[model samples]
Target: MNDNNARRVVSVIVVNEASVLSRITDLFSGRGYNITSLTVAPIPESKYSRLTIVTSGSVRVIEQITKQLHKLIPVLRVYEHEDMVEKEMALIKFPISENLSDINTICEAYNGKIVNVGENVVIAMVSDEPKRIDNFLCAVKRYNPKEIVRSGAVALER
Candidate 1:
């Protein structure tokens, strides 16, 4: 595989501390790794945080990243998601005048629903597989979405 096109999602469990995020990001930047998506949040009732990072590189480069991450003082565990169930959440806002019924139908198709409705705007939220979310975005283009926000990928080993 080409070095630039290989996509991998890596999950890192690290101590929840102020400088941990900066240290981890510095590691990537120093090594010239490009992170496509990054999400960090503390695990409930625990002193650790989960960092979900999406990046691309060749197999060798990924292995190097894994090894380096393991060497970090705050990092506890790292997992490269393989055969896991991953999901992403997205929210889209569009003009309310543009057929609310049609928007609801499209949202339903993606296992989403209208999350908010105002006089001028309608907001829909969806949590689905990455590919499905991508398709949903493509399908809703005709609505002229005012804004779209997608959350980082979250995974559970199945």
Candidate 2:
């Protein structure tokens, strides 16, 4: 994609209520915009939830999205993240035959550790920048992972 289509992160704070997520997603779908990743969770001690959305578009398109978000009744705030700290979590399961020590060391490097050891598998959890998590997945390929699940990016402005 061109620079105009560079990836963007948009954070939306909205009232916690049914259909809120559906409404937000519908807005993107209605506009033919694809959301690369989305993470949502209730804000502590409040009736609001924060939605972190990752997508790509021209500056104009992003601005349009922000404006549309503000028009949503439940949406209380919307902003495109500029300088932020973001992280994603991934869980990978490998056969027990893999070297445990090596897996432990690799996980440690990614701010993670082996979270569980099953009778036949070893499960590791890693939380790190999205790019670094991609690298970690590549680094562990030799172990023959059985399953992998990754979370959407969660971010906070710095």
Model number with the top TM-score: 2
Instruction: Estimate, for each residue in 70-145, the C-alpha lDDT of model 2 and write its tens digit.
Output: 9999999997888999999999999999998999999999999999999999899999999999999999999999
Which stretches in model 1 have alpha-carbon errors above 4 Å?
1-4
Candidate 2 residue runs with Cα over 4 Å from true position: none
lDDT per residue for candidate 1 within 1-158, as digits (tens), equals: 45666878899999999899998899999999989888899999999999999888888888899999999999999998777888889999999888778889988988899999998999999889888999999999999999999998888667
Q: Give the whole-model CA lDDT for all candidates, comma-separated.
A: 0.90, 0.95
The 10-residue segment of model 1 with minimum total lDDT is: 1-10
TM-score versus the correct structure, for each prediction: 0.94, 0.97
Question: The CA-based lDDT of model 2 is what?
Answer: 0.95
